[model samples]
Target chain A: MGTVSTVLSPPALRTGMALAGAGFRRWATYRQAMLAGAFTNTVFGFLRTSVMLAVAAGAGGVAAGYRGPQLATYVWVGQGLLAVVQLWGWTELSDRVRTGDVQSDLLRPVHPVLSYLAADLGRAAFALCSRFVLPMVVGLIAFDLYLPHRPATYPLFLLSMLFATVVSFGVRYLVNLTAFWLLDIRGVIMAWLLCSNALTGMYFPIAFLPGWAQAVLWYATPFPSILQAPVDVVVERGTAGHQATVLAVQGCWAAVMLAAAVVVQRRAERRLVVQGG
Target chain B: MADRPTTAAAYRALLGAQLRAQTQYRFSFALDTAASALITLLDVVSVLVLFRVTPALAGFSFTDSLLIAGLANAAFQLCDMCVGNIDTMREYIRTGRFDAVLLRPLRVLPQLVFGDFSPRRIGRAAQALVVLVVALSLADVTWTPARTVLVVIAPLSGAVIFGAVFVAGSTTAFWFVESGEFANAFTYGGRDFTIYPVGIYPGWFRAVFAYSLGFAFVAYFPGLALLGRPDPLGTPGFLPWCSPLVAVLAATAAALVWRVGVRHYRSTGS
Candidate 1:
């Protein structure tokens, strides 16, 4: 076992790179599913854009500081980010735990959580190139989307996206760990997804929510860091300093959630040992 | 030497068995039901959030829009409860369960429908019903006996229309074993589309859903009739009353497609 640990103990960066690459390749093979996802995202993007535009029209061409073009950009970019962040329907870890396949995962030298995170990063990388770009291109053709002129916006948005991905993975990892306690984690996952989608600004801008609700979402949950911050950065909704602050908040949430996941996994591992898994 | 049960009896038997099996896991069933209800709540909240940003959408006041949304939600949930099993057709086909279904004594479609009856889904249906009731109270409709009857039957018509879409979507699984996601573009997408006033969409967009797909008859036209409001887009006077006929027609066409699909499956065995 000592020798095996030594053999498997590569630098964390190297392991993450390899896992991410594998994750990218694995999802790349599902060409049809990717195409279908892209199509659906674009269609929903159009629908959301239309609804937001109507809202703008009703508010005399601007609602909640969003013009027609800005709203379009917001909706389209939100669609692109949906696949990247992927706040729902991710049950791989729970399924493995339920089926006892996680035993093999535990045996590997790499920490299971890190490996899964790496793979998710890889999936997000692929999704950014394919799923993300597809909706953006469709939006560009179909609507006059807002484009950030500042060179800084692109790098900041990328940073925000990366942080959002980490935050999302952290939440999903913690949710999946519930499988250790519950035989069926589907209901828990579904409930988390419903709440996450609402709070993450996936359905609508979190700002549009009531002021008290917005305060609770911003201060009480890590949801906005998952989608709203990144989209805000891209749309240049605020000044550079405000964008920097959003990115920092996203980073903090990502770190906190990742730490929480590690603590939960430790507890879950102890539970598994006691339960004779 | 016992007499065979009628189709209705067979359906009830299958549904009862399914409900019994689900009820065996009472805790899990309750949890799932609550989760489904929460999802419906979030969906309605999303619509309400949009209304919060604006006083009206597409010439409809917040209350009127909520009524449309509530009706659409109730209709979609009812169809989802009945025909949502279509989502699993791909897996059945892949695992050869489709063959088992085919060999059942009952008609294949009814068997498929009954085999996947989920009592837990009523949670979302009940949530949508609350929304409908709230919308009815808020809106200034005449609430005549005939209008009330139309309102009651509207969701039933929606179920038939959406159930037909689900059937058509499931039929495609006979050819493409991984067609669930593709089918979602229609079943789920159509539901999302109808929850809002159709006038918000562009001309071509409205034309496809309203004319080609006949989605306008599902809620928008009926909503207009119930509210005693004229269609801003100038739909014919008879269009609103045509929802039931449209639903029946769509279901019939879907049944035909399903028959063809079953024949294809029998020949290919895939």
Candidate 2:
């Protein structure tokens, strides 16, 4: 029993490491997309920020607890944060599976769930450098958005954002795994995109939303924690205790989703075996 | 001479082939259509949610915004259906499929137009029509002969503008066949641009749409005419009429550029 346990532990760790390594290599080849993504985000950020400023002005200097600089900070940072969090265009795993690439993945020694997590993490890391940091820096210099000047706040904000990354990736992976059942994923993705756009505080802040709607969105989806919470931490001078609690909740959700992925994968593998795939 | 059987017959042949090809994947084709309709419906729902929270967006009333959304969706989908193959030009060239297309006896543009037809995009068209019907019932659009004329031309002119953008994007494949990213600014970005009122954007962005890209025709200026909206930026009365002209210019520019790109493509064979 002891020898069996010892052998399994090493293989699990090795599988994780291999997944991460393979993920990083694949991401490295798509450097051009990373750069182009950054540029497109920058354009969109500017356009969105302009509209937000106008809306804020029309609302008589503060709509939903945000003055000019505060609103600018929200709009600009939300763009950057969303880049890292990526609430849009995350249809990778489902597409691969639908194209029958899941068969190749099943052949791997590592678990399929770990492989997806690793690839997402690797891609998120690349996106952070190319889309988030660079664009935020440009917005900082060009638009003078209010940024985290306090040292402690930055670290906490980073932690929340990292939590956001993990949770968002988990939700996306869970959604992708559904492709095992649903052949057409476009409807599902579109629904996610619309929901995330509204709830992630991308187009408008959650604070601006009605109380009932805000309460529902906060509990139903991980959207707020993924983008708004991290940016709000920066804007509110890191009074992020509640946000931290939310992140902790997000972590729990990620665990639940990961477990779900394992169950689904096992069932799917059995089905594949029966079907002679 | 202009109504020659060859031209009309060629168009029919191309469309027929496209229809037959789309019928090949029966299940996938149905799902694609259903999925697209659901997506557009979902987006409309989001807009409806926004309207619930605020009575208006950017001073436009609920019905007004709905009208713009409906009209824009119709215009975008119609043009998208017409020139949808442009987006796949790079793939065609990269896979050496363009060679087979070139070997065909029909005019290159006609064959290209006929080669790829997405029946599923009817999903978007159907959604747009639904929105238009709903918005018409909701909004009090007192129709005049002139207003009716403007409404009909609005979508036709919008199609021209979007088709021009499609042509421009396809032409770029001759130079940067593998790099389809830059083309997004013109196609996807342009569609988003048209969905919103011109007043929502800043002067520079507006200028790019008005003067540089000439994309204002697709929805904005024509929308003002349909909605009887005042010039948000204080433009002349004739400016609204500039939509049809701008569309023609954009289409002309795209054609000229495409000719040059095709010449380069034939010479370099890349």
Candidate 3:
């Protein structure tokens, strides 16, 4: 236990990096699966782009703040980020908790939340390189996409993506932690998956939603930061100052969600201890 | 041989057992039903948002598009209720549990279909039915007796078409255990593709889905016939009635593929 404290204090950074590297290597081994996934994403990208472009064309080249080319960019970029943020179909942590394997994870020296977050970052890193870049390249060839010329826009977009990954990981961790109380969290997770996919601007732009719904989503959920903010920065929808503001808000949400995850994990661990797990 | 039950009786018994097993977890089943229904609602809402922004899709009015989406949803859900379990065929094949299925007295495909008979999926079907009713009320088409019959039979034919796709996809598991995701591009992706008027898509896309995949026969052609609208892309006037034939042909092809796959599995023992 004394070694656990020492390991937590100074060398935690090293452990985190090692875990991330391991995660990257683990996912990279599924080369065939990755290619198939990339292909599927690209196919769906064309479907979505067709729909959006059709709507815009029907409306005489503008609908809900999007022109034909802008809508295409939104669709393809959203498809790319979908794999990067991984908004659904992850059940590893909750499955572990249900089967009592989470106890082993708790017994490890490192904090479980930090370990999962690090691993998720590595997965996100890999997805960005493979899944993310593939769709964007296809989009570039298939359609006219918006590219921001401002130098600051590129760095800010990257920062927004990093924050988006963090926010997504935090929300997923919190959802999985509900297993401490509910024996079967699958239903809850399913409901969450449906909501997040719609609300996270993956299915369509958040602005296309009704005004009241958009306002509620903007203020109440951290979903838009996951996809919309970064894509908006890349597309240069708003001014540079506005882009900075979006990044700042995204960063803040990520920090707050990560903090909430830590607090929830602590409470869950105490409950587990009380129950003699 | 004298004690053997009829095939119909065997199927009924299998479905009865499945219902009993499913009802044993009543609370979880209810939750899952609601969740499935809610997920289906998202697609409707997405379509609604699109229509809210634009008056028409390609040339179809909002109500017309709604009718297309609703009929497509109803058809897909009906097929999904009966055959969606094919999505898990790979797991059974991988664990060698499929051999037990093959050894049973009943036919393998019927048993597989009945084995996963889920009452919970009725929730999605029910929602689609409601959408269909709403679309029928809103769309300006005159509902003649012939048109009404077409509307009623459309979903059934659509179910057969989608079921054929599911069977074909699952049969691939015998050759490639990890083909589930690839199969999804056909079954699930096909459903997504049919929700819109096929004419709005690019030329190549329309060609593939309409001619190659036969998805056009699923909803688009039938929808035009029911609505009394001509095909904007100049398809034949008689094409709408070809949906049933296309569905039967697809199912026949799927049955042949399943036979080949089963033969291969027996020879390779994998």
Give each prediction's DockQ, rounded to 2 decimals: 0.61, 0.28, 0.53
Model 3 lDDT per residue over B167-198, tens place: 88888778875553667777877887888898
Q: Candidate 3 regions off by >4 Å?
A: A1-10, A271-277, B1-30, B94-100, B103-106, B266-270
Ranked by lDDT, the better of candidates 1 and 2 is 1
- Compose the digit string of candidate 1's lDDT tens values, residues B1-270: 244557678788888998887666556667777877788876567778898889899999987888888888889989987888777887788777788887777778767777887876777788788888998899879878878888988999988998998888887778876453677777777887888899999888778876787788778888888999988988788888788899999999999998899899943354
What lDDT score goes with residue B155 in model 2? 76
Would you list the clashing residue pairs of candidate 2?
A: none
Which predicted model would earn the best TM-score? 1
Quote the positional error of residue B184 for candidate 1 in Å: 1.6
TM of each candidate vs. truth: 0.93, 0.83, 0.92
Per-residue C-alpha lDDT of model 3 across residues A1-277, encoded as one tens digit per residue: 4744654665897898889888788788877667767777877887788888889988888888777887888888888888788877677988887777888889898889889988998898899899899989998998887777898888888888999999988888888888777656656677677768788888778888889988787667898888888888787776888788878888889989988998899898876632233
lDDT for model 2 comes to: 0.70
Find the candidate with the highest DockQ and give its number: 1
Candidate 2's residue-wise lDDT over B5-101, tens digit each? 8777877877788788666655545655665666566445545654544555567777877777666777788887778677788777667777777
By lDDT, rank the candidates, best first: 1, 3, 2
Query: Interface-residue RMSD per candidate?
Result: 1.8, 4.0, 2.0
lDDT of 2 by residue, A1-277 (tens): 4633643687776776666677667766766566666666776666666656655655666656666677778877777777577677777777777777778888886667776777677666766666688778877876757756666777777777777887777667766766776655655665566667767777677777778888877777677767777777777633456646665766665666677777787886664521235
Candidate 3 residue pairs in clash (backbone atoms < 3 Å): none
- Mind sharing the TM-score for model 3? 0.92
- Native-to-model Cα distance after best TM-score fit, residue A171 in candidate 3, in Å: 2.1
